[model samples]
Target: MDVLIVDDEPLARERLTRMVDQLDGYRVVGQAGDTASALGAISAQDPDVVLLDVRMPGEDGLSAAHQIGELDDPPAVIFCTAFDQYALDAFGTDAVGYLLKPVRAEQLLEVLEKARRPNKLQRQAKQTEASQSSHNGRSHISARTPRGVELIPLEEVRYFIADQKYVTVHHLKGEHLLDETLKELEEEFGNRFLRTHRSALVSVQHIQAMERNGDGHYQVRLADTEQRPPVSRRHAGALKDLLQKL
Candidate 1:
């Protein structure tokens, strides 16, 4: 299996590379010093597994792992860090293993033996399960676009409207169709978004005003767009209460 080692220490990287090279089937494909270089290497090499460090200069490994998970076919991540405190957090991601610094040859081999890339279906299932169980929620939403998988930051999103089986993500750039239900979106992003109607969930941060239209129906106006998603009578009171807090 191809492996990528990410560590700020060159000596540490060399040691891990030597250990991986000693293994019968695994080989070190590349090495990165920081999360930015690591991401670039992953894009260039597409390694089967990544031995990542927890802390670095810029973006930490945990945050990098989240972005890596957004990829359509992400490599298995095996954290190699000195801190044991981040073990629980590491497992929260799609990590296959977690080895401490000064890793033993035996431990590396054992972890590598079990590290295997998950299929697309398995990945999707794991992502769904993780989203359901995670309390902190995600910072970005992923969609499969015609070009490739696009990672849309949640801050850019205006609202999510249910369209039959799919949910349309209306964001600053444009709309992207997602194969998710409004219920799942609500469960994952309830803290950031509010349910304006049965078919729509609007961003609480983007809501500018709530006013009654000519027909005596309530509607919400969001920032950066002219679209006014109707507020259902059942949810209008809750919307008003939330708006008052803002």
Candidate 2:
């Protein structure tokens, strides 16, 4: 299994990497000191599991994991914290495993053996918990890229369309398919995003026009883009009101 070690302390990362290297069927692919770097490493390396630290300078491991949960094929997160109390909350986050620091080799091996990829439901639960406990919603959306994870500010977003099991975020630059659901996003962003379709939520700020197609289907056009997601009957009236207010 590929592993990424995320800790603010160099000593902690070195220790975890050494222990993981000693184990068979596992390799330490990368290491990061902060949440952003850890996220970039996870996106770039596609590690099977991450040994994440709870406390850090910027975003903590738990909060970062919540954002990571939105990415497609997110790695299994195993939080490594000095706080025993935080470790006890692992089950609520749906983490496969966690280790209390200073981690022993045997404990590391045990957790590795038990680690598994989290499903959509598990990721959602983690994000939900993070949102409920936090004062504000997420400022940026994380998207996986070959080089690393790209942070897209919510301001640049045009719309969110739920395609099958995934929701695509249409932003200023481009679009990214995320593991998040439209409902989750709606709850997260609140009044910022208006439901335009059962499978779509559009940014009120990005609303350019509402035009009817040849089939008499009204599509909500966005700013700085040609893409127009169809509006469903249920949400069309509300969308119209939102546009009028905007």
lDDT of 2 by residue, 57-116 (tens): 988888888876776546788999998888666656757888899899999998888783
Q: Against the unseen true structure, what C-alpha lDDT does each candidate score?
A: 0.83, 0.78
Q: Each model's TM-score?
A: 0.49, 0.49
* TM-score, cand. 2 vs. native: 0.49
lDDT of 1: 0.83
Model 2 clashing residue pairs (backbone): none
lDDT of 1 by residue, 1-246 (tens): 779999998999999999999999788889999988998887666677899999888899999899888753467899999999999999999889999988999999989877844433244445545655775878999988999889899999999987546789999999899977777887687667777666788998999999888988788999998888878554576687777989
TM-score of 1: 0.49
Q: Which ten residues in a row have the lowest lDDT in candidate 1?
A: 116-125
* Runs of candidate 1 exceeding 4 Å displacement: 117-246
